[model samples]
Target chain A: MHLNYYQKEDQVLLAVDCIIFGFDKENLKILLIKRNFEPEKGKWSLIGGFLKKNENLDEAAVRVLETLTGLNDIYLEQIHTYSKIDRDPGQRTISVAYFALIDVDSHHFDGIQIDAAHWFDIKEAPNLIFDHNEMVQKAKARLKRRALSKPIGFELLPEKFTMRQLQNLYESILDKKLDKRNFINKINSLDVLIKLDEKDMSVSRKGAYLYVFDKDKYEKKVEEDGFIFKI
Target chain B: MHLNYYQKEDQVLLAVDCIIFGFDKENLKILLIKRNFEPEKGKWSLIGGFLKKNENLDEAAVRVLETLTGLNDIYLEQIHTYSKIDRDPGQRTISVAYFALIDVDSHHFDGIQIDAAHWFDIKEAPNLIFDHNEMVQKAKARLKRRALSKPIGFELLPEKFTMRQLQNLYESILDKKLDKRNFINKINSLDVLIKLDEKDMSVSRKGAYLYVFDKDKYEKKVEEDGFIFKI
Candidate 1:
């Protein structure tokens, strides 16, 4: 089963690591799991797995995310690939890092497989094993850049969310205090949200009106004018 | 030397393909080479090579570019990874695609290694082998995105370039006509360019002033104010 052309080449382990990001009411969080294997056993690490022979890297990332959170159809993006020679102490492995956004309240974990997994505030995340911390930093920078040019932040919010909640998500990701009036003006200019009669009563006495992202209008705008959703 | 943990896992051949982009006065071009080996012999393909055991993906990419162009310290970026199982017909090779920007006139080729290489206008590029076309498309999109957020357009331009030449590079990358006044205003707003007194008289009777990208100012601005060079 050996091929002559590839015989002299080195074949190394290829793995995929997921920087699963979630948003609660107050802050941004990341999903971290305690490793159960050797060479870095019982330490916090990004939820990752080796790529299977039958699957592509994207599929492997999805499988890893599903294995941890029992969630399907999440918003996932391949952030970057880390291939430092000594990035992994145990082996010369190249990891393709992916960032995923999920609504925190909607997807509850399946207890059996992810007993060691926990959500950590992105700011207070524990030091991770084998370049996982570097992966997190890169993913966060990518998420911030993406949040500016695209409407991907909506993926971290619930289906119905208030404008203040959306602003909070952006502020948390960008880690800057945005002018409230300016933020509202910019969002209104984009015209990608639809206001609903329902109210989010949990936040204030005079509840803010709920809004949903207008996917149809967004797609149409993108197709027609190449609209860029800049914040 | 088989590790017990990796005994049952699959290992595939990893390769790196670089889409080398160059800018001429009139249009953008790509460097493509005729394949000299099996599985795609004699066909036009990207400048590429298999990754070596000791080097990481970036190093492999740099090596491949240097082999073809005989240049170092050029602008190179990893665009994406192509891991479709059947992408390479000769073997199950996963290619990490990179896009490199070089000044075509500045870096001459090393004759012996790049005998079959040729520069083709991006619009008139030939059909490439084994999903290379898709890789080129992705790289172009990434370059466009990067050009907007960073001062990467200067990478494709000569050190001392006229304002019209700079605008043309942007128009070619974005594939749209931008208003001259608007574009100039935006560039002026960035304040990351040094206008030189030297003029280029090749294009018109009244010469256009030349300018150079201020790398130090741009870096300092990025560090100080989180500057985004949006155009």
Candidate 2:
């Protein structure tokens, strides 16, 4: 066989860990699960699973997220790979961390109680097991950067939302207050949002105009005009 | 034995591949090596090696890059991880791709003719084996994006360079023609460059002023003022 070249190479377990982000119209939250296994039993940890031989990292991440959350087709991005020799004390494992964004009210948890999993406001997240804490921090930083340059924030917002709602989402992800006028100017400059005729009157008697991210138009503009999205 | 939790997990071979970029004052280039072993013998490929048991991915990447280039302290960034089934014909391997930037003239190969390794202009590089081409493309896109928002381009240039040199480097990486006036204004607005009292008289009679990236000042500004670098 022509396999001698790779015969002596070390094989290590590959795991996929997910940092799932949710926006409940007010705060940025992360989903975490309590460990049920021996190494770190009862400790908080990111939802994760080992990669099977047939599936790729992306598939593994999606499968792991779905298995834990009972949700499907969530927006997942592979952020970074962690490979410290002793990262996972129970085994020699390298984990590829993925971040996902979901609107809190939009996705249902398939009517089953996921007792181990719970949502934590990003700021109040408990200490996670292994290198999972570092993984969450890195994923959060990536989310902040992506939110600034891409229209990804829309994933965490309802289809129709007021401008204040959009700014609030950005503020939560960025962890800082943005000047409202400047925020509006920048969003308008992107020219990828559609102002709908409907208004959200729940918060105020003089309702605020609602807007939705026009993904199709945004993608078409990027393809045809080489539009680079930036905030 | 408390090992049953992870005993049945699949372990696969891991590899580290590097997309090494260099600039020789006039153009951007990539380093490629001819594969000497089986499965893809004689094919051009990125410098890569199998991961070992003791080292983390970063250390493994640095070791692999140093082994092939005979250079150390090169600036390396982990760009992405590739894990598609059948990616490597000889074995199932997950490869983490890292991109490195080095000033071509500043470092010399430790003097034994590494005839297998060569630098090709970024635009003129040959077809690479086993998804290496895709890795290169992704790395180039990252470099372009990083150059616009960070001072990383300085790693590919001499300590002091003329404004035209810096602009050329950006143009080459971006693969676009930028307006000279706009490029200069944007770079100057970042306030991370120190215009030297000295001038480079090599290119023209009325010499252009040379500038050095002020790393210390840039860091201080970022720390104290929360300055964001953009160009």
Please name the candidate that would achieve the greatest DockQ relative to the true structure: 2
Across residues A106-211, which tens digit of lDDT does each residue of candidate 1 receive? 8888834578889898889999999898899989888886666666556788888888888889889989888999999988887889999899888899988999
List, residue by residue over B74-133, the lDDT tens digit for candidate 1: 878888888998898887888999888987888788844578999999999999999999
Interface RMSD of each: 3.5, 3.6
lDDT at B132, model 1: 99
Off by over 4 Å in 1: A1-3, A219-231, B220-231
Query: Candidate 2 on B104-159: residue-level lDDT in tens?
Result: 88988752226788989999999999999999999998887666555556689999
For each candidate, the alpha-carbon lDDT, in order, equals 0.83, 0.85
Per-residue lDDT, model 1, residue B205, is 96
